[model samples]
Target: MLASLLAGLGLGFSLIVAIGAQNLFVLRQGIRREHVLAVVAVCTLSDLALIALGVSGIGLVLHGVPWLAIVVRVAGALFLIGYGLLAARRALRPAGETLAVTGPATDAASSASSGTLTATRRRAVVGTALALTWLNPHVYLDTVFLLGSVASSQGDGRWWFALGAGVASVVWFAALGYGARLLAPVLATPRAWRVLDAVIAVVMVTLGVVLAVGG
Candidate 1:
């Protein structure tokens, strides 16, 4: 059991720790200080649910219906390409002046107005989170196929391994969603936003194209 748990933890971390679309979105939200908690919950819970499904042998269904993977890949690629274009626009056009100038404008009333802004963007953020997590073929490949196959090999210890994987997912998203605030100072500049958005744009577009090509 202990070995299975450790194995799960290591595998889980290895799979999720990479800088992917989901993680990058969470980091951006954290830096923006907008809907961070909600984003974290959605990501972590989605991961746990997928891990559960994988442990319960959903991978067999996935493997049998290979078309499903292709469908997801196509959808994911389209979404990523669209999102990448949006990010590229942001990189080109930026939002406003630096935080140093607008810092004072964020008073109670402004904060309240920002609350409204956050509320409106919440839907978009949640939708993107879901798409990024569920639509990506790699997610199914990793969580359902790879993780499930390995867990099944553990026989009786598979559930323990699943639990460890779930725990790692939770911890990683929590840290990423909240800890990113530490970089808020650095991201206060428009140049910083431009750079971040530009990088995200490239990543999203690249991944989208790769998925489209079935790579």
Candidate 2:
């Protein structure tokens, strides 16, 4: 049981620690300090639920449905390409004031001053978080198919393994979402933001193209 748990935890961290669309989005949200908690919660919860499904052998069912994978892949590709274009636009025409880093006090004041706008922004952020998580076929492939297959090999220890994976998801997202603010100072300038967005654009578009091509 202990070995299975450790194996799951290690695998979970290894899978999630990579630089991917979901991680990049979470990092951006963390730096902006925009609905960070909500983003973290959404990611962590989604991961846990997926891991559970994987452990319960749902991956086998999904594997049997080839058309479902194709549909998801196409939809994910389109969404990623669209998002990438938006990021490219931001890189080309950055709104310096909007991207400027602010202290907690200033953010509080601004939120209070523009309550309605803040609420709207919160909803948008949450929606983006959901879209990013759900629209990525890789999430299902890695968490559901791969992890589920491995968990099934654990036999009686599968549940323990799933629990460890769930814990890893919670810890990783919490650390990533909260820790990214430390880089806020470094990205305070518009030039830095432009560079970051350009990188994001390239990565997103490339991934989309690869997915579209059935890679």
Candidate 3:
């Protein structure tokens, strides 16, 4: 059981540590002072629900579903391509300096700031999170199928494994959201956004091709 617990922790952490669109959105939102709590809650809740469902025999069912993976892969590919295009668009935009004013600030100081935070748009934050979670078929495979298969292998201890993984989700999302915010000063810069968007584009395209090929 101790070994199983450690295995579960390692698996959970490994899966969650990747820098994907979801993590980027969460990090940007945390820095922007948007609904960080809501974002974290929804992300954690979604993962918990999916992980629990996966552990409860759904994993076996999913494995038996013929061509479902192919369909998901196709859809994921299109989604990633679209997201990559959007990131590329952002990358092509003009760069500028921005202020990291939170809550309220002095007028003189605020005036001295020359740029606007385009990423601070609240709707974009929420929408990006939703897209990263729901549109990415890899998420389903990882949490619902892969994790589920592993947990179910434990027999009665499957529930414990799921619980442990779910707890990890909560901890990870909370930390990623709030923790990234601590670097708001650097992350709020236009150059930083461009770099991030470029990275996102590359990651999305790579994941898309991998999903489409299914290799």
Candidate 4:
């Protein structure tokens, strides 16, 4: 069980820690501190459900439906491209920086609605997070097919393996979502934000273009 648990943990971290669209989005939300909890919840729960499905042998079901992945890939690519363009616009048209400025907001209600990580955009953030997670076929490949195959190979310890992977999910999301505040100081400048968003636009757009072209 220990060996199985370690194997699952190692694999889970290795697979998840890669620079993917989902991770980048999570990191962005973390930095923005907007709907961070909601974003984290959606992502973590989605992973848990997918991992459970995989360990429970839903991979067999997905294996028979190859077109499902293609559909998701196409949809995801379109969404990502649009989203990247939006980010690029934001980067170019810089909003007043919201980095660690220590002062009480003038109006609580206004700040809640207008600030970077405010409640007004909660719905949008969650929706984007879901699309980023579910629309990407790579997510299915990682959580459903790859994890399922490896977990099944663990014999009776597959559940234990799943458990370990689940733990990894929790740890990674918690650290990423909650731990991103550490960058507030460094990201306090509008210049920093421009750079970050510019990079994000490139990554998101590039990935979308590649996926669309079946690369």
Candidate 5:
């Protein structure tokens, strides 16, 4: 049981450590301070729900439906390409200035930047969450299908492995989104945003190409 738990943890962390669109979006939100809590909550909850669904035996359905993986892969590829293009476009455009804050700090910043922090385009938290959850086929493969299938293969202790995986998801998303605020100042600069946008674009494009090539 202990070995299974540790295995699940290692698997969960390994899959999530990649720099994907979802993580990039969360990092961007943390930098802006806009809807940070919403972003974190949505990400963590979505991950937990998916992990639970996967561990609860739904993963078998994915394996049974052979065409489903192809469809998800195609859809995920397109989404990544689109996101990459958009990020590249944003990188080329004049960067907008806005500050995201919470608690007293936000209120204080709002008062201070009343006229300076103009309204700019931002991704809706729920919309972003859905995109991250559904648009990426790799998510299904990693959490729902692959992880679930592996957990199910663990015989009597399958649930323990699943629980370990689910816990890791909660801990990771929370830490990445909230813990990241500590470096918000560094990420808030226009140069930093530009660099992040570029990196996001590159990562998305690279992933898209790989997926398209049957990865």
Candidate 6:
């Protein structure tokens, strides 16, 4: 049981530690200090649920439906490409205040003062978090199919393995979403933001193209 748990934990980290769209979005939100908690919660919860489904053998069911995979892939590709274009636009034409790194107090005060704006921003952030998590087929492939297959190999220890994987998801997302603020100072400048956005645009578009081509 212990060995299975450890195996699951290790495999979970290995799969999630890659530089992906979901991780990138979480990092950006963390640096911005905008709806970070919500984003982290969404991601963690989504991962846990998917892991559960995978452990219960839903992955096998999904695999049997080839058309479903195709639909998800196409939708994910389109969404990624659209988001990538938006990132490119931001990189090319950044708004001054949007990228400004204000003090904590000022940011809190501003958010507190603008109730409607804050609410709207929160909604947008949550929506994006949901879209990014759910629309990405890689999430299903890695968390569901791969993890599920490995867990099934554990036999009686499969549930323990799933628990470890769930814990790993929580740990990783919490670290990523909260730990990213340490880099806030580095991303203070407009030039830095432009560079970051440019990188994001390239990664997103490339992933989209690869997915579209059935890679």
Query: Poorest 10 consecutive residues of model 3 by lDDT?
Result: 97-106
Deviation from native of the Cα of residue 86 in model 5, angstroms: 25
**Distance from true location, Cα of 114 in model 6, Å:** 2.0
The TM-score values for the models, in the order shown, are 0.62, 0.63, 0.57, 0.61, 0.57, 0.63
Q: Which pairs of residues clash in candidate 1, taking residues 3 or more apart in a chain or in different chains?
A: none
Candidate 4 C-alpha lDDT tens digits along 73-176: 56656765775687688788986645333332346687756766555568788999999999998788768766675565566787788888888898988787
TM-score of candidate 4 relative to the true fold: 0.61
**Model 5: per-residue Cα lDDT over 1-215, one tens digit each:** 98678656755664564446787677667655666777778877888777888877654564577676566556656666676777777677735754454432346566466643423223456677678877898888777865665565455666788777777887877776776767556655566666666666776666566656753
Give me the displacement of residue 191 in model 6, in angstroms: 20
Clashing pairs in 6: none
Candidate 1: regions farther than 4 A off: 58-111, 114-116, 183-215
lDDT of 1 by residue, 69-125 (tens): 565556656766776787789889987645431221245576675777656778888
Residue 147's C-alpha lDDT in candidate 5? 61
Backbone clash total, candidate 6: 0
Write the number of the candidate with greater lDDT, choosing between 1 and 3: 1
- Angstrom error of the Cα, residue 12, model 4: value is 0.7
User: Worst ten-residue run, lDDT, model 2?
Assistant: 97-106
lDDT of 3 by residue, 1-215 (tens): 76456545645665665546677677766765567887887788888888887777654553577455455446646665666676767777834545434542235464446435433544565676777897899898778866675564455566777877777788889987788657656666777767766765675565556546652
Clashes of 3: 0
Residue-wise C-alpha lDDT for candidate 2, range 140-200, written one tens digit per residue: 8778865675565566787898988888899989987898887545544667767767776
Say which prediction, candidate 1 or candidate 6, comes out ahead on TM-score.
6
Instruction: Report lDDT per candidate.
Output: 0.73, 0.73, 0.66, 0.71, 0.66, 0.74
